[model samples]
Target: MKYLLVREDEDGVEQLWGRCAGVDGLFVDPVPLPREVLTLRGCGPDGILGDVLAGPDVSLRSLGDLCVEVWDDEQPVQWWTLVDAVVVAHQPHAADPALYDIVLGAGVRKDESFVELSAPSRFELSGGTTAAAARPSRCSAVDGLFESRDDPAPVPMELIGCEAVEPLLVGTQQPRRWARDWAELLVLDRHGGVMASRVVGLAIDGARPSVLGDGLEDITLTDGGDGRPSPAVRPVWEKWCQGPPSEPNVWAAYDAQGRAEWLELSTRAWRVPAPRPDRSGGEYHVDGRFVTDVPGLHCAIAEALLGPGRYFGREWNAFEDCLAGGFGVIPPFTLIWHDSEVARRALEDGAKDAGERLPYFEGVVRLLERRGVTVLLR
Candidate 1:
């Protein structure tokens, strides 16, 4: 079954965040909702309906019995079929492992926190050691946003939900409300119109306010300027291309629309980690699992370094294809083996063939550095 993810702005204005196609978890393809839709969902002027929404303590068994009744404000009142699930996630700065336990208790296989782009930020392009020392190659098309800079921090947010069957409500801690990194989702009826939407603060208890990175705390960007590529950028890209092949790398060379086309190319070279003998089934690999056997610990490092989205193999021509597609010089993409175990196992298995693995990993670091991806070692 399909699901919609929703969140509110700092002003408490409820808005459409994103929609999950079935239950894949990553919220994508943002859309807008109408204000009138709020009234239909039984929301007051505040865009929330305590009268209609469920509570944080909703149990999984009760979902089948939950139904949302919406009425149009106009005389010929339209009847809308929508159900939401309310999740009042209790998140302290040091996240309780029990939260995951609770969600697992609710029957969700896996969950992750993500920052939906409500307000994208900008950073100045600089070489190094400056306030805005971001990787210059990543965001060439966008002007000032670079590759290596940190992911934008989470802003304050609230939760809003009613009841929907087959609903998976997984929540994560966010930064301050000022950061504007709250979670959001969009709703679409069976007919595919913006039916309804909601948003709310992600309640933070004993947590320190989150800040994504230091350096240029608030250095805004202006249009039109030329900064030479960082002294470290291309040699790294070339060095990896010259080295023995590892994971096939793909660049973020396509626009949001053309993404599928590039993705097809990347997937052709996509590498699935070692297979399980008992359960050999089709599974898209999580990029993080490439490094650590331990889930969550090294996954964050992999994602933080690689950036979000379903990443695949990198092609040198795909980088040019981005430029050809009118995306100015976009960031170069590279893939490397961050798995210490993989290297260690290779060494244990054999010395002669395994020798190149560590050096290959080193080249990956330099390559990722030039392209502006973060490398986190646990």
Candidate 2:
């Protein structure tokens, strides 16, 4: 029960999955059913016959061996094998050239035919003995128009029997205007399903932008008239630290006076461990943390300051998209402080023997400072 899965690429038949019973195959260009229909008929008892369709479980083995054979006007031109799936599979060269100039296409389901319009175009419909037809409708004003065969033409202004007359006041007057006022902000939950929390404008510094919940009340604004912090702010602070309120030691939220408003009592308070002195010889530790440690917190802060559409998750493709969109930095923040122990460990792990730590720390300090982030060298 061998089956062949053929997909169209820039060249004809970019991918092929062959020889399997009950196996699914993907086809980009519509498959001619003659070969498969004949094959199914030949399989009598135990040959190869069942449902044949592309599915998620379909596998592509020998990915490197697959090559594209392109033809120039019905003549074979060249054959090029992909270097790697990650590289070749997503390359712009894989797109079919013939589809580049396609503007419109139609789809028919049941008795109705739907004509899809792509770009700017005008269309007219005429009926009642094509030769002596009246202007049924003029759809030139529409940007993109489509109508069913049974839809009647819109009533024309002239048919209404109304005559145009100039107004007594010929001069243009200034339009009434209203002052822009602050509106209540909305926040959404992580799954984007429901409103998580809501806060007044004063609490979140006048409706700060946030990702977690819907409505202004859901966010932690700057302290409102009430001294106590907004309820939504506490959860946001905990989420940033990558620890819940129960984990007190790991995180803390302090007021302007440096008083602990909300605190987590976890032993691990966002600190990187010091480097071992014996193995690397005459070494010092740099205590700091990686941006990856509290990605949610970092992302939230960035969103608040820079607004939405700036940050990218750990996904490589998203990172590439950010780069393409002209974003110079990933996190887009200045490092205010770093643990000196973390830098020392990285150096100790990289060096063969003990060495002066000054030069290494200097380089680290320079790099961090250049990015407007403070590096606390302990």
Candidate 3:
């Protein structure tokens, strides 16, 4: 059976809607509601409904059947859905030694299973070195603003408004290579402020966010050219593309003829260990068994590296064997590259000097595949 594996996170609900909305066939499951949602419900209407509805004069009451009804401004309205499913459970004994006891006991799996899927933090590396240097602290005030809790807090006035603002012309800028016809572009000033611009109708190139369109381009900039735009300017037009983030890495899916039809990227790093030798002179190698499922991506990466030529060498055989043996199911693969000209020269000369050089290249490709990484061998 085919499965659409969803890695759960804080924004998982939104991601579920974005990825599975209107899909032809697929089972959708969420591991569990966040702690905040659970606690909010427990705190009664004031917690779950927010303080806006529970001001000094507001009143609320919990209904008998796993539900809560709230009264705001002398009007009682709104109902909450509640289920008696297990919120948490612990199983001290199990056959699988690696399995943990902590579990969010939701219920029996039907078409979909709601399971929490978590990976190591970006600060935790397989190699034991703290990758935290590159990550922002979770305890920061900015992050705390969105932290989930057992109870919901009161809404601030700044976030509430009942007035509509007038539309304003922003400014113009350069077009991107993937802009399509009638695409909208939003320009941001140095202070992370958005400027308004609309694509009337014209053939443009490049994808969204980086898209360049014809028509009226709204540009926003400070009068002094200090690079920061006034916060007063906001986009009056709608965005054309609604894909995921494009930072850390971008993956484009291709058809049999090498035509790209889909693209995916991570806004953040996947955060795997760097493939390198330890003090013992032995490096952790990834199993290449997963390569078969991603032949197109493998080919794309190989072509990007070896340049239009199919990978031909003993390395290819090793890659195949690794896949056949299901090595990927174990330690997995990791991809790393060296930017030194000396390393490239060595690889070239080694390949020419001995037939064994092909194996080295294959090993690299194999590791990359196992780790779900598409290395852009430059």
Candidate 4:
């Protein structure tokens, strides 16, 4: 958990850079920047080098016990370490020893792959800037920088520790994070056959569906416009509306917690007919319903059974393939919704020009159910 902060001083010389402490309460001194260190200048102005460093085309090397935090003034820009990384290849430039590129697996995921970094130039921290320098080539303070100290500063080490937080904490962009969320949803479906299944978009949120766990509240259901549900939902909704008023229904199993969640409803305003009874047949009303939230266990079934894809429109059955082993069995995924019910209806009814994929929406749900998903409908 020790961090080595790296930054440029006012004169652009490397000073004791980090807020990290030694045995006593003083700031840790700058060590010889690791030869493995990747620099901003190496990334080039267009960020071509940075992209090369992050791209999947490279290999990984070992990340030793140390972690590095880079700062632009007081604000941190990047944090990384050589610890736990895989070293695939190292290419040193024949023209300059300091100008080289090394490829290493960058993140903490088991399947995490490689990113390459080019040290285009020797780091600017080369010469001794002080009067005590004996050898003019190297910094005279280099020895003092590495020496462990026991002298206490004005503040306690504990106080410093509390104030200076580690900057290298992993983020959502990490493959590990994406895999974790995707796996959580698949596991819920595997254990409890899709606790909640509803198409979300259009009247609800007017966007494609994505897999949202704790983010369900972010997609608030809308209660405006002609309340008619999207065509993708109209057929089933029409069938359900034919019976008694569709009571606030809930289907929950695995992650079922009794909390209120919002849902968009598009139906005939039977309880309160339009006052004028307009002959234009625009009586549909879109409203929101509060149901006991359970999709967290079942992955929060607000709407949008499938999320849209990268190249095309909404991919309703993409989740099926994802569960069936798309996205590396656990790739990054998000909730998506269809633009309109008509679009989904066409996909479902196999309309020639409008749809091409066979509609197996119910069958897919059943498949997950058979695998152990407990479907609770209320």
Candidate number achieving the greatest lDDT relative to the actual structure: 1
Pairing residues by index, what is the TM-score of model 3?
A: 0.16
TM-score of 4: 0.15
On lDDT, the stronger of 1 and 2 is 1
lDDT of 4 by residue, 32-110 (tens): 2223223122212111122223345555423232233333433333333333334455454445544344444332211
> What is the per-residue lDDT of model 3 for residues 234-298, given as tens digits with 9 covering 90 to 100?
11011102222222112222232221111111101111112122122122322222222223333
Distance from true location, Cα of 212 in model 2, Å: 28
- Most TM-score-accurate candidate: 2
Per-model TM values vs. the true structure: 0.17, 0.18, 0.16, 0.15
Error of 3 at 209 (Å): 22
Worst 10 residues of 4 by lDDT: 179-188
lDDT of each: 0.26, 0.23, 0.23, 0.24
Clashes of each: 27, 42, 19, 43
